[model samples]
Target: MNEIDPFKLFLELQLALPRNAPGSARATREAFSLLPALPPRPEIADLGCGQGAEAFELLRLANGRITAVDLFEPFLEKLAERAEREGVPETRLRVLRGDMNDLPFHDGEFDLIWSEGAIYLLGFEEGLRLWRRFLKPGGFAVLSELTWLTDAPSPEAAVFWEDAYPGMGSVASNGEAAARAGYRLIGRIVLPTEEWWQDYYMPMRAKLAGMRRTYGELPVFDEMEREICLFERHADEYGYVFYALRRD
Candidate 1:
C-alpha cells in the first residue's frame, strides 16, 4: 500500500466544506450592511474565494458582477459548478485562478474587494496596502482575519498561534494598520463562536475521525487533532474578526 500524502489528505478534508473558514451568510450580510451604498451592478472582486460561499452571498446581495479569484484551480472549478447550479448568469460570475499576492487585474479595477478568512496569506496590513491600489477611489475593502481578542491569552494558545501565525494582532492594532494603510475603518465585528464550529470545525472534526480510521496515526493528523483540542479549550482567547474599510 502507498503511504498517504498528509498534505493531500489535508486538502481532501477541506473539499466541499461550505466556506473555507468560520463565516455565515448572516455575518456576510451584516458586513455588507456596514458599507456605504454601492452602485447598481457594481463590480466586486472576491480574493481567495474558496468554494465561493461568500461570493454567492455577495452576488445575491449586490445583484452585481463578481470576479472570484483563487490560487487553486479545483476551488475555482467548484465555484463555477456552484454558480451554474444556482442559475447564476455567466456574465455575473467569473472565476480566475491566480496567486492572491499577485493578482492579475489592473489597478483601480473594482468597486469593492472582499476576502474572507484568507487575508493572512499576506500579512493583514500588507494585504490591505497592496490590494488598496486595486480599489477605485472611495471603494470599499472588507476581510476577515484571525485576531487576539484578549490582552492575556493562555500560554499554550499563544504558542500555537505564534508558531502558526506570528503576524496575528489585536483588534485595536489591526484598526491602526487600516488607518495607516489609508483606509477609513467603517466597522469591525468578532465572529461568534458558533460560526467557528458550525461550518468549519464541526465538519472538520467528522472528516478527521474518518481519516484517522483510514490512516491510523500520523504526525500530521496528530497535529491537526491537537489544534482542534486547543481551539475548543481556548476559543475565548482568539477569534476571526471582520474589518470593513473604505479607501480615502
Candidate 2:
C-alpha cells in the first residue's frame, strides 16, 4: 500500500473551515475604519486569503474591488463559490492563484493590502518590506500576526512556539518593524480569545476528532492535539494581533 502524504492530509483537515485562523468580521471592520477615507471603489489586494472570510468582509466594508491571492487553488475555488452564493458581484472580487512573496501586480497598484494569519509565512518584518512596493502612496495594509502578548510565557507555550514560530515578537516590536518598513502604524487590536475558540479552534477540534477516527495513529495527529492542548493551557500568553498600517 502507498504511504499517505501527511502534508496533503494536513491541507485536507483545513479545508472548508470558516477561517484558517482566528478572526471575525468585527475585527476586519475595526481595522478598516481606522483608515482615512478611501477613493470610491479603491483597488485592494488580499494575500493568502484562505477561504476569503476577510476578503468578503473587506468587500462588504469598503465596497472595493479585490485581487485575492493565495497559493492553494482549492481555497480560491471555495472563495469564488462563496462570493457567488453571497451575491458579491464578480467585478468586485477576483480570485487568483499566486505566491504572496512574488505577487504579479505592478508597483503602487493597490490602495489597500490585507492579510490575516498569513504574513508569518514571510516573516513579519520581511513581509512588511517586500509587500510595501505594491501599495500606492498612503495606501493602507492590514494584517493579523501571531504575537507575544506577555513579556514572559509559560515554558510549555514558549517551547512550542519557539519551535513553531521563533520570529514571534511583542506587539511593540511589530509596530517598530512597520515603521522601519516605511508604514505608519495606525492602530493595533488584540484578537479576543473567544474569537479564536469560535472561529478556528472549535471547528478544528471537531475536525481533529473525525480525523483521529480515520487516520487512527499518526504523528501529525499527535502534534495537532498537542497544539490544541497548549492553546488551552497558555492562551493568555500569546494571541493573533491585527496591525493597521499606511504607506508613508
Candidate 3:
C-alpha cells in the first residue's frame, strides 16, 4: 500500500548493532600499540564513531580524553547510554553530535584521531586530508577501511564493489594516498575475517533475517544479501584494514 523508505530501513538495520563495521577491541589495541608515543594523557578524536566501539576500547587503552563525534544523534545517543552504563565520565569520553566533514574542533587539538569503518562517507583520501588539521604534530590517526587485498577479485566481487564503491583501492594504493595526505605509515593490519562476523555481518544477518517478512522485497534487502554473499565467498580478495598512521 505504501512505498518503503530505503534510507530509513538502512538505519533501522544498522543503528542497533554494537559495531557498524568490522572491528574489535583487540584490533584497536593492536593498532594503538603500533603508534609512536604520545602525551601521557592524549587528546583523541573518534570521527564517524557509530555506537563508539573503538571509543570504548580507547578508554581502557589510554589515559587520554576522547571526543567521540558522529552526525547521527541516534548513534551518539546509544554511545552515551553505553558510556553511562559503563561508568565512564563525560570528561573522559564526551559524546558530540557532529559531522566528520565539517568538524568543529580547533586545529592541532588532538594527539590521536581514530575512526573505525566510517571514513568512506568522505572518500578515503579526502577524509585523511581533511582531518589532518585536527591532529597535533606527530599525532596518529588509525582508521579501518575496506581495501582490495588482491588485484584479481572474482568477477562477482569486482562487479559488486564497482557499483557499491568504485573508488575502492588496493592496500598499496591507499597507503600512497595516505602519504599524499601527509601521513606516514605506522603500521597496518588486515582485520581477521572473524571480526567481520563477530560484531558486524553476523548481527546484521540476524537483523536482516528478522526484517525479511517486512522488507524482503526492497532492493536494499537484496543488496545486503548480495554483500554478505560476496564477503563470505571471496573474502581473500578484500577486507577491512586498520591503517595506523602518523601526521607528518
Report, for every candidate in turn, its global Cα lDDT versus the true structure: 0.91, 0.90, 0.90
Clashes of 2: 0
**Ranking by lDDT, best first?**
1, 3, 2
Candidate 1 residue-wise lDDT, 5-67, digit = tens: 876887778884776889999999998988989999899999989889999899889978999
Where in model 1 is the C-alpha error above 4 Å? 1-3
Error of 3 at 199 (Å): 0.8
Badly placed stretches (over 4 Å) of model 3 are none
**What residue pairs clash in candidate 1, if any at all?**
none
Q: Supply candidate 3's per-residue lDDT for 28.
A: 89
In candidate 3, what are the lDDT values of residues 1-248, reduced to their tens digit?
A: 67888888888888867788888888889988888777899999999998888899998889989999998888888999989898999889999998888999899999999998888888999999999999998889999899999988989998989999898989999999999999999899999999899888989988988888866667789889889988999989999999999999
Locate the minimum summed-lDDT window of 10 residues in model 1: 10-19
